[model samples]
Target: MRPMNNAPLDTDRPNSLIIAPQWIGDAVMTEPLLRRLHARGERLTVGALPWVAPVYRAMPQVAEVIEFPFAHGGLQFRERRAIAKRVEGRFETAYVLPNSLKSALLPFLASIPRRVGYFGEARVGLLTHRLKNPKSKPPMVAFYSALSGESGFDADRPQLKFSDQDISAALARQGLPVSGYYVFAPGAEFGPAKRWPAKHFAELAASLDLPVLLLGSGKEAELCDEIVLLSNTANNAKCLSLAGKTSLTEALCLIAASRACISNDSGLMHVAAALGVRQVAIFGSSSPLHTPPLSDQASVLWLKNDASYQSPLDCAPCFERICPLGHTRCLNDISAQRVRDLL
Candidate 1:
């Protein structure tokens, strides 16, 4: 974890200001990176957004968490500048994770000695250790882990460590079956376009011989309820709707207990990858190549434009919410049968 010269990082002399990733999911994805940074020394602090503070509130890897009070993608030079002023004398190196040019300005303004990040918007001189974004990133876990200059990992391998007590606690909370149960995550926050058909989820539940737990945020509450209600079972007892129930950290514990996670390409899906839980990730209106799950057990199902849905729109890869065309062909055309086949 030595920065070139192997000198001790200085909080009193010069500390490291590490800019965190945006979104809980992205921040979760970068955990390995944080661990590597932590190994470097004990004086590293994270510069993160106010909303996403919960993601790393208790990470053993972070010494201090610096809150940046401003909307993501908004101009908060005042806020950023203020933070820069506060961290001015401490940071010797800054690791900027987000690709935004503005994300780099803080450490630069703080006048940190060395800045480390990908070479984006041509901030060559600003960052001292400009890592060339790898040509072939292994898996999600190892991808960011390279920042530590020691990426010994397997892309197909899932690798997050937790305590035995935590595992037992999570399973106990889940009410362990005589036999283990399957898990379903039926919603994607990026948009409804990423969601599978609700009735199809119910059908999937019915098809499974084991018990099920459905999980997601309150945003996916209706979708979860629909899945539970639509299941035409004797008691719908097989499916336990855990959606909107667990906190993100709690959900991580549960996903660790799951045998497999069937999900849309969403934060939970990324969580599956990080946890190295077996995953069946379905993709539509998006390219798997750009955002493929970085796990060997992580399988992806994406739609290629066929005659029925020719023309992958100019805005097709726009990654926008509420498709402008309103057709939702990307997801609508996807069938439950496809998901079943993967499962």
Candidate 2:
């Protein structure tokens, strides 16, 4: 799917284009920097952001995606110069994962020789190979796998492929019953201090007896129909919201046929930690050492305010979307039996 129009820069194999990450959990942590640039053979494409372009079209180390029509944080500039004149000469290298000088203005207006990224805002001459923004906040899959020059913080975790007839036609179009369920994801598009209390996810879906879907976006479908009416008023469990009724590749094929997902450090908790599933992930106002969930089979709770569940608020992770000490005691003292004893 690579033709966005200026097609002719294939120069024998080492391609790359990237420029993704306009959220959906930083484009699922740029899939271990597109699996370290497709394990060094480098053919990836990306540019995304039509709501994260189906997460780089379900990434098989991306060969092509390109949507980027611009709007979120809109600078427009003749619509990013008509998407840099339709990707001017296909791509030699661009990378640039959102530090926003309009995300390095379309690989410095598509001359794309070697753009690369990370010198935020002022974007000094729009990056010819910038780097240097790391003074500590790491783990965003080792901050995009250290922009693929790699050097080990251990990478590979965001995987995603899907198709068993698209997870059985998205669980028979969300009538959802293909497997024993449990997928919560209680909404946090970076606000409400990385949200966690939808009545503590409706009392941990009425103490987990299974069948619980939830998921998000259509502005979290009235907070997932108020956690499916507060987990069906105490326990007839089958709680289902299917928020905004599916589609981000059918919510990654219903979090790849969930058996466990819980979530809240959003983007379907990094797509249920890239479908290795069994996640838990909560965190508050964000910080699992800067975006954790590269899944060691996932399980992080991190409520901050000096962890053992609340009472220190020296602004716990105060990355602040709304809790300017508005007492989101780091996500209201994190309990629901400490997320149902990590299930």
Candidate 3:
């Protein structure tokens, strides 16, 4: 057994800080690492951006979640230093998840005794223990799991928990019944190259007897509205665009209580998988081999893997925000019926 700093391994549960990833999918994938840390008797506190903080709440292992008010892109040095003062001497070790030097700066500013993370972004001085970044991108779950400094958790599936009361409240607020509706998360934060066509989503919605609820951020509300308009006018399917309305916790609750969820290779796709909800994840510019939904109930659809798919996607898994070739047949070629059949 590994000793907890200066304490006996069996009795003392050392205080530990975890610097969480900004994206919801990446945050969800870090659950295995958190779980392992908890099992080894480490009390965990997660520091995360406001957008991703709710994800840590779903994890039973997290002792606390501190929401950071940092904006995207720029390094907020003064803000980090201020926040670091509040957390100083509270944690013995800090696990920095994102490779950016800014992400590692907080723990260093807090004067955390030991900081652990992957080597990248000229942060050699920031982290006390650094793992070499893999030359090739590995599965996201495995990539995060390796942060635990332990092996053999590569195949572990991420899991999240929510009380029935919470789920019921969300359903009541949304006027949805348990298992009476299907969730369609048609937006991808990455870009158009990763999203399945809105028309295909509309077609699938029109085919379903149950109501299809489209969920996403405010930025994606317009896209969801397009699906609703198309499904209603073209095929008279009952589709509601609830994209910008719900809170992240409400969204998680809704997904947990739904019959099933269908989504692009995005954050909500991982949320559904972590919640153990039946989900069909559509992959486009990205490869499932790298960031697949880590759930047995998840059925991934990637045309790149289909030998029967005509004009083999030799250019697929480009990992691009938009198709460099301008066509994006990778997502366009996957028929609505194919997705409907999986559901």
Candidate 4:
């Protein structure tokens, strides 16, 4: 974790603290709002979960980052009270990002003058200013920006700052070439339904005839290994499974250096988009309308399964982690040839 800035607050500047979202993609989407807040001359501090802290720390817009120590879905009321006490009377307002009642607890406990968030989880008294969530889900970027009273379907793409020196160092450390490589993100933290088939990815990598780097978290290392093996057999080209090998910052730099990136709808896709990497994002069991990559360089392909395989669910975007029907035709229907054509 980066050391917290303990500098005295500027009295002339209005201080604001944002309770950041936990998910990596949602955390990336929050950048536009942070940028706008900084532009308006609000000294910004982000309260982030431990895992997602790197996202805000990379942003120049953030003045400071406070690591929220509690585990996801774990209340830890005493811990919240301790945190509130530590940062008491520091900020004039707090922007609560998550809808959970637990998310609003710290700000309310600290007695921050203004608390703003959507009405959810019976948090009526916790928030001083309650915004109603839209009935229909909007793109996360627009939805988050709207919290600050900014109205738009579009916002500036999420940008992360990294030095070329850092990128070169990361590449050297991983024994990877500096350029002429394509990245494939085959892991989706959401569930298997959001992931493109491993066979399809292997086929695509084989046809590309370029160095392929597979990026993912430690959990996806096995999956990436399988793809690498299959790809090597198919094309006899170099395919390295770098899953779990690089840090988040290293992964960001690698994506920035790639010729192009092909990924399932996942956090790395958002990171690639943020870095202005040309990306082909595949979607299944989720709606692009809800959280599409906020980059003009991105091309999205959605494969919807209209026919029911076994379960009775008729909708294409079931939004469930695991497909209810058990058959993932939504992902299976997208051919390797189609994805290769995009590349």
Task: Highest TM-score: give the candidate number.
Answer: 3
- Best by the lDDT measure: 3
Q: Is candidate 1 or candidate 3 better by lDDT?
A: 3
Model 4, stretches more than 4 Å misplaced?
1-3, 153-156, 305-315
What is every candidate's alpha-carbon RMSD to the true fold? 6.2, 15.5, 4.5, 2.9
The clash numbers for all candidates, in the given order, read 6, 0, 0, 0
Model 1 Cα lDDT, one tens digit per residue, 256-314:
77878888777777777767778888776556665666677787866553445566545
Alpha carbon lDDT of each predicted model: 0.70, 0.79, 0.90, 0.86
Angstrom error of the Cα, residue 155, model 2: value is 32
Model 3 lDDT per residue over 110-171, tens place:
99999999999999999999999899978888888898889997669999999999999999
Model 2 agreement with the true structure over 112-158: per-residue lDDT tens digits:
88888788889889888778888876777777777776677564668
Cα displacement (angstroms), candidate 3, residue 336, comes to 1.2
Query: What lDDT is obtained when candidate 2 is compared to the true structure?
Result: 0.79
TM-score of 1: 0.73
Candidate order, TM-score descending: 3, 4, 1, 2
lDDT of 3: 0.90
